[model samples]
Target: MLESLNESKKLLPERVAEQIISLIADRELKAGDKLPNEFDMAQQLSVGRGTIREAVKILVSRNILEIRRGCGTFVCEKPGVVDDPLGFAFVKDKKRLGLDLCEVRMIIEPEIAALAAERATSEEIEELQRIEDEVKELCDKEEPHMHKDIEFHEMLAKMSKNMIMPNIIPVIQTGISLFINITDYSLTKETVRTHQMIVDAIRERCPQAAKDAMIEHLASNQDKIERLSGL
Candidate 1:
C-alpha cells in the first residue's frame, strides 16, 4: 500500500514520485514486477490519475521502471542503473579517458579477480570458461570480439559475489569499448592469452594466481595505451 501525499507540497508530481519509490522499497518489489494500474495506484496514493502518470514517467526516465505497450509498467532489470552513468560519451578525448579507465581498472580489477577466484561457484567458473573460449574463437577468426571481451570482464565482476561489483559494470564496459576503439584491437593474441590465463587461474580457484593474471592482462593494455599516447 502507498502513503497519501500532503496536498500542500509543491511539485506534487515529484512528491508523488518519491512516494511511489518508497512504496516500491516498502513492498520489496523485484525486477519485472508490475505495478498496480493507474486508477488503482492513484486511489491507493490518494492522488489524481494524472499525477500518477507524471510520477511513472519520471521513474521511467530514471531507469527505475519501463513501460510495455500491452503489458503494464514494471521494474527495470537493473533498477537505478543507467547505461552511461558516468557520462563517458560526453568526454572529447577518448584516448585519455581510456587511459584513465585503465588506471582505475588496474587499481580495482585485480582484487576483483581474486575475490572471484575465491567466491565463484562451479557453474560461474564454467560460464567464465565458455566466455573465454568465445573470445579466443572470435580472435582466431579475426572477427569482432569486443563484446565478448566486455562480457568476460562483466562475468568476473558477477563471480566476485559482491553486490556492488555488478553495478560498476557500466564503467568497465565503457572502458573496454574505448580501449578497443583506441587500440584498434591490436592486442588480439595478448587478449586471448591473458583471458585464458585469467580464466585458468579462476578455474583452479587460485586467488593469487588470478590476481596476478588479471594484473598482467591489464598491464598489457596499459602498456599499449602508454605507447600509443607517447607517454
Candidate 2:
C-alpha cells in the first residue's frame, strides 16, 4: 500500500499517471515507440484526454517521457533516476496533514455506508459478506488487515449501487494510511459490532436501519477523533 502511495505522492497527477507509468514499465513502452495519439490512449486507458495529458506532462518533466514536435512522446531508455517530487524522501507525515486527512475521511465514509445499505443488491451483499468474513479472519489472526478493510468498504460503496459513488470512494481510500485504529490491536468489539450491524442491516435491505447504524457508528468516532486531534 505504502509503495503504491510512495510512487503516487510523487506523481500527483492522478491514478492515470500511475496507470501510464505502470504500462510503460510493465508493457515496456520503449524509447521512440510512437504511442497511438492522445485520443486513442484515452480510450485505451478508459479515462478522459485531460487525465492523459496531465499524466504525460508529469512524465515529461520527470524525463520518463519526452514529447517531440508534431510526432509524439516516447518513453526514455534509461530515464536518469527521476528525482522524487519532494527530493526522494516524501515520507508520509503522521502529524498535522495525516490527522486532517483522516478527519475528512470520517465525514465521507459514513454516508457511503448508508448509501450502500440503501441500495445494495443480492450479489453485492454476498460479496460484502465475503469481504467481511475475510476481514474478520484477518483480524482474529491478528494480521494487518487494512487492505481487506479498504476492500470491504469499497465493495460496500459499490453495492450502494450509486453511480456517483465511484468517485467519492477513492477520496476515502486516500487517507486510509493513518488508520491506526484498523489493525487488530485497536480493533475493539464495538467496532466489530458496528460493522456487523451494517452488514446485517444491508442484508435485510433495511435502508434506514443501515443509515442509522452507520451514522451511530461513525458519529461517535468522528467526534472523538476530531476533538482529540482538534481537527
Candidate 3:
C-alpha cells in the first residue's frame, strides 16, 4: 500500500507515476513483479482509478510496466530504457554516433571489467569461462561468433555486481551493436586474444589487469572502427 498524496498537488497522474517509480527503485517492487490491481492502487494512492490508469500508462510507455489483458500489469525484465535507449534516431550523423559509442565503451567497460574481477562470484566466474569457451569453439569452426561475443560482454556486465551498471550496459551495448552492424564489422584474432586476456585476469581476480586488458581491447576496437570508417 502507498501513502496518501498531498491534496493540494496538481498533475496527480504524474505524481503517482513518480511514486511508483520510487517504489520500484526502493525494491518494494522488482522485475517481473505484478503490480496490485488498478482499483487497489487507486485506493492506496488516494486517487481515482482513472488517474491510476493514466500513471500506469505513463510507466508502460517508459517500458517500466506491461499490462496483460487478463493477467494484470507486471514490471519489465530490464524495467526501463527500451526502444533505442541511446536516442540514436535523434542524431543526424550516424557515423558520429558510431564513434561516440566507441568512446563511451572505452570509458565505461574497463572499469566494469575491474569491478567484475573484484566482485564476481565463483559461479559467475565459471559462467564467464563457459561463454569464453563457447566463443573459442565458434572461432575454431570459423563460424560467425559475433552473437556469442556480444553475449560474453553482456554476461561480463552482469558479473560487475553494480546494480545500476547491469541496466545501463545493455543499453550502451545496443548502441554499440548498431554501430558494428553499420560498419559491417568482422572479428579478428587480436580481438579473441584480448578477450582471453580479460577472462584470465578476472579468473585470477586481478582487478588492475582486468581493467588494463579491457582498456586495451576497447581501444583496439576503436582504432579498427576508425580505420574501417576511414576517419
Best by TM-score: 1
Model 3, range 34-152, lDDT digits (tens) per residue?
98788887887888999989999999999999998899999997778688876877887777788888888888899999999999999998998899888888877777777788888
What is the overall TM-score of model 3 with all chains considered together? 0.85
Best by lDDT: 1
Is candidate 1 or 2 superior in TM-score? 1
- 1-231: candidate 1 lDDT, tens digit per residue: 567877665699888888888878988998999988899889988888999999999999989989998889999998888777888878887778877888889988999999999999999999999999999898889888878888898899999999888789657667557544545468999988988899899889999999999999999888987887777
- lDDT by residue (140-213, candidate 2, tens digit) is 88777767777877787777667656545655454434442433336445556777888998888777787777
TM-score of each: 0.91, 0.55, 0.85
> Each candidate's lDDT (Cα)?
0.86, 0.66, 0.83
Give the Å error, residue 218, model 1.
0.7
Where does candidate 1 stray beyond 4 Å? 7-10, 175-180
